[model samples]
Target: MPPRCQNILLLGGSGLIGRYVAEDLRLRGFTVTAIARRYVASQRTSADDIEMPIMTMTADQLTHLMLDRKIQMVINCLGVLQDGPGMDTMAVHRDFTAKLLAAINAAAQPIQFVHISIPSAADSDHTAFSKTKRDAERLIAEAGIGSTILRPGFVIAPAAYGGSAVVRALAALPVADLPSDLASRQFQPVAVDDIAGTIAWLCEHGDHTHHVWDLMQPEPVTLGAVVDCYRTFYGTDRSTRIRLPGFLLDLGAKLGDATARLGWTPPVRSTAIAELRRGVTGDPAPWIAATGIVPQTLAQMVNRRSATIQDKWFARLFLLKPVIFVSLVLFWIASGFIALFISYDAAAGILSAHHFPTALVGPITVGTSLMDMATGALIALRRTSSIGLIWGILASLGYMFGAAVLTPDLWIEPLGALVKTGPAIILMLAALMTLDNR
Candidate 1:
């Protein structure tokens, strides 16, 4: 047995698996320092949390961090599903792994390394996401450190994100019949607690042999079955399962990919579809035997607890999120376009009628329209979405106040355009609240 270590460093602590593992390890009496780029306010724990850009950090910096913290173990949960703005598969999976390995090699004391990886398949290297992950695995093996690589299949955590969020949304919606080919693909799921339990077991009984294990349930299940399980959980199993066309799925993926370039990490992207088609399956016998853990079945996982009102709300809102954002974008941009080009004279006439601004009417109309368009553009990009939402709310309030003061009669207009802005502002607030994917 290897030396038992208590001080552990955990990476990607804000992620689904990382957050659970961090809390679990701390409960098991280990001193865990969690490093994440950002932490959700609701998800924040009592553990020592460090917010930093892990991707940009160098090996020297990581070494110093480990040394400073007196880390005796490292659990890496950091990873990306697809390439997008500020997200590169090679940089995250390969380059980061290489740097992390270098830091481990340079550590003054021996540090146990535990890495979370994906299940392997015949065409695993088909996509850049999978290819880079495989490259990282090779680097870890070559580093010659005391390491263990765990490949978990379709992790079923209480908290939903990424592919899991997509799955929940599909189960909640009535129009979620998948293509037969994709639906029939094998999908093996493992409970998130099982993963944390395995890590805890490793820490308690240190295994000297560098091992790679596939962590999943023993029984086989299809993608369709997994969806059915979730649907059952949501009491939507009685709904008809109309066959969804492949073309629609393709179109959705293209849209997802387009949004990814704008900094949104939509779960229905091309890479996600490609990986889903590949399916999640592996031999979990080794992991079961090694850790003495009996993985939870799909039924067991879903039926573990009753679904709450919040769970149902989340599932329904997950599907409605894209619709809300798209509608907001169109509403803002279209309003601006009409004011700038289609209704330029009418827009100027409003300001002119408001009283005495013969020289400023055109400029005010044009400037406000431009500002409206700019707000929409900012909201469309994930990075500036919050600022855009705030700008939109403020602009709407300004318009309301201006109309009430200058042309109070306009507030009682038959169209009630001003009245509708209230709901639009509320929608923007909703979008801002649900913006964070992690």
Candidate 2:
């Protein structure tokens, strides 16, 4: 019953809203344990910091942690559009979410769960991912636990962790396209931090049994105007942010599903696009009438979570592919020089004694040589870059062992081989243990 306790379990803590929500709870003196691909436990002990005791774990790992930890609240902030790997993203969002609530229910003192959701949940069956959410919502409702679901739309976050990445990117384009009709279509883009603050409010007031909250900002603004505001905030007007036709939108959604399976970023799904274009959301006044949580205005939302406060390097890294290319090349050049400098005698001994190509070849020389070329090329490509790093790290162990074992030709130097090979043990282990690339 004490969902506001110091200890809470949050799913999707890495997301824009999740991060803020976790932070907000910590600010309110709650001990937060957020689960994502990684851990983000707060190190700050300041009164403003609100340290959330977070823990990162995989699905199987989570089950174990839940069984052992003194978890009082489980917040399902995990929502997905493409429904990355596993049985269903929505089930993880909604049904498994309910299951978590049920586990809390079975506790001597039940756990309180707060779910973040979106509109059209009942009709979510039209798509595989969201439909799972729709079903999960129903299951959670049936579970008869103390739970709440908050559905919001056009959720504009200051960072790159959510489905609105393309929308935010489009807003920054130098000359973005704006449809005349879309320029007038109303939207209530909710701010990330506002949602976080509101969630903390709901957790404290769970006694209200106010199950649903349609998060909306005050006053509806046209979509173009929204883009324009974001563009102004970002100081860009280059985005050709034109609206796609209905047919093309549907096609894109299919492509998103297909590409999602292949571990590629798919175009925005036409189904969601079409739904937004069609203006499917209704008034939020009734929900406000129920929970008394007035939505913040665009000005307020922006003031609290302005893009200016976001780290610019995050976006710059996305734009600078050439920098990465140059670094890889430089690394290759440096490796060659370092080998020549450290193993000049070994190089001369082999070259003088053995045949031209044969002397250049030894397990250490060949294996490490292969690593340099492979890693260089791999880093050059977008798809294989991460995998390439893993290979480069693992391949070095073979080379380093040979450097200490067989003839030490002038490929990767003994010290260099050890440097490259050591820490990669974990990297290689992580690669081999991948679940879904997407």
Candidate 3:
């Protein structure tokens, strides 16, 4: 093989690790292609973006894609922390990988396969995540292809996402609720850049067909220390750690497992907790000896990616955003219910006093009341939130206009009932501005 692989294919290029890997390889002037089920904005090559389900694709289709693309090196950067409704870790990590390896074996040209495997995968008895990863590693080894299995520890980048996002969130909490057993658990968190650079170097200079490198910094830092690093970076108050019993921690994980069913990937899932409890650390000799790259320490990594004012605010407001979202939903629903049931007769009488006929008063009251409830319902749903917010704003404006024209006295009423619409409108607008389309 040449010093620089001519054509490289990156699977799971949409993911954080894969994105970094692709960029690193591209910067080194290698011809790189990235393929994933979802569209990744970073993938620039038109030929690389194959937006199709990997698991569903047949062996022949995959083999054709690899050979047709003239991919000499294949990097598998796929893994899932938690399994949910649409995400099956076993299927992707194990089954899909098996299919890919089989395709590689059948291909006319030999492809150098790079597999991302978890540390301690061989020893891990719990969690399907670890087991499936180990199973994938076995398949890759048995496929008789040139393969490099990278067992990296906690991979961190300049900006955190996915599992790292969860770590930052936990670290930013005002008070840390940790399992008592976890304080001493240490991890050799590796910089993502190191992982990417090392992989690139391996593609160029590697001599062995099969190798397992532990990609991480040699220094072992405790789990609590990792959290503290983030907390310090964000300038959050030094967290007062409260340790919970093992049983309580287990219960929380169980709850997280249940919540995953609702399409929410809670950070504290049973598998995640199990992995954390086990800790993530690996030997650094193999990677350093092969790649000739010294890994950055946690402090070094943190210094390079110092948190800005916006980053700090974002970290603090992570949970606050959802809280505010839910609060707005409740506010609209409660306001609608109160207006519909309690203020009906009073509103009807007010309309009548303004010469809205008595018979029409009841009909108009029901109609407006139903509209209020409808707006609330719409706002409460993720799909129709923007529409609901607009409706709410319009409804509030309409109510205020009607009051000003018909019952002007209510604007200056002692309770300021009519005046409340102004604040309600402002709140609705605020909620609309923060609407998450993604």
Candidate 4:
């Protein structure tokens, strides 16, 4: 049988929303080709193939991929809350959208397009993230392609990414520290699976009459209430609540902005703070009229998913990962300097006892210390962080092996300091896992 017009190509398919949408569409018997920046080999399924690391592909390469797959419709689910390092708000949301649309237009047959955007006022949206999204919408409309734009509010997902990570982290905190002025700020969080199902249904039904739909819950809930719902579901309803003043919130936003400049993408930023202060709630009339699917409320969405150990760990450690990484870098660097300060005679005596020549001790100790410091500096740098992490892991393992072979007594020493190397290596691995800030 020949493929239908709904042969879907999903961009950002490895992301929280895109993953669910692609899988949902596939289960409904639609041919899906998902493109993402990165994907694991195991994520591939019989119904779909996930092609990844496509961010660096040229426009011609992208066009070829689309054409080769016989993609009749494209669903762009790409989104990022903050820009960092290789990420640019304008490039991702505006330039890329324009280029993709142009590629689709250049194809032999016309293709339908669906864009997953967020609610934002064009004139009042000061953040680059929002402005670029608005620009992308305008470009889509001007292209005159058969398109549907979906603007959703507070998309709730099991994965901790962007705003969802922040919400989970804050809700997991022992005390909820909220901005005093934000008490009245409203939101209508919707489940990601629900949005994905709606998009899939629209694709199958060919409901292109509604150009734009605000996918949100029927009733609005306050920001505090959203957090409260999470807390209650997570069994933390009795947690203390403290309202922070406006000034403290501003200070935090500034710090978050500073971290972003350093190539670490923290969820709390000036733009996010600004958006939260203004609040986000969209009218659900259009979505309901077209789809006839009632969106789940924030509370109901929270109850649908049972909390797991992994979720709890992720919620608590999401923000602390960067802090721990930075601390590890500093410790590695400081240890090198401290070793250098040790007296030459004292170092020689220890090496002499371990059968190292007195003359060779000086060069070996100095070289190793220098290498340690260099590795730490490289790891601290954003550009070379990945390499640095590999270096750190090797260095840690080398130290342990050398100590065991040369001075086995150190392992069982009274201080047991050498045993701590295991944890240090684990920490390095953790940092390496999240080193890809782009």
Report, for every candidate in turn, its global Cα lDDT versus the true structure.
0.89, 0.58, 0.78, 0.79
The full ranking of all candidates by lDDT, starting with the best, is 1, 4, 3, 2
- Give the backbone clash total of model 4: 0
lDDT of 3 at 287: 79
Question: Which consecutive 10 residues in model 3 have the weakest lDDT in total?
Answer: 40-49
Q: Pick the winner on lDDT between candidates 1 and 2.
A: 1
Q: Model 1, clash count? A: 0
> Model 1, 304-417: lDDT tens per residue?
988899989999999799999989888889899999999999989888887947988888899999999999999999889889999999999999998888888887899998
Best by lDDT: 1
Per-residue CA lDDT of model 2 for 4-83, tens digit only, reads 54567777776667777877788777877766654434423233232332222334554455656676667777766655
Q: How many pairs collide in each candidate, listed in order?
A: 0, 18, 0, 0
Judge candidate 2 at residue 105 and give its lDDT. Answer: 54
TM-score of each: 0.96, 0.63, 0.81, 0.85
Give every collision pair in model 1.
Answer: none
Stretches > 4 Å off in candidate 3: 1-3, 40-50, 173-179, 237-268, 332-438
**Model 4: residues >4 Å from true position, as ranges?**
1-4, 52-64, 207-210, 241-264, 341-358, 381-394, 400-426, 429-438
Write candidate 4's Cα lDDT for 12-59 as tens digits: 887778877888888778888888876655456644666666556667
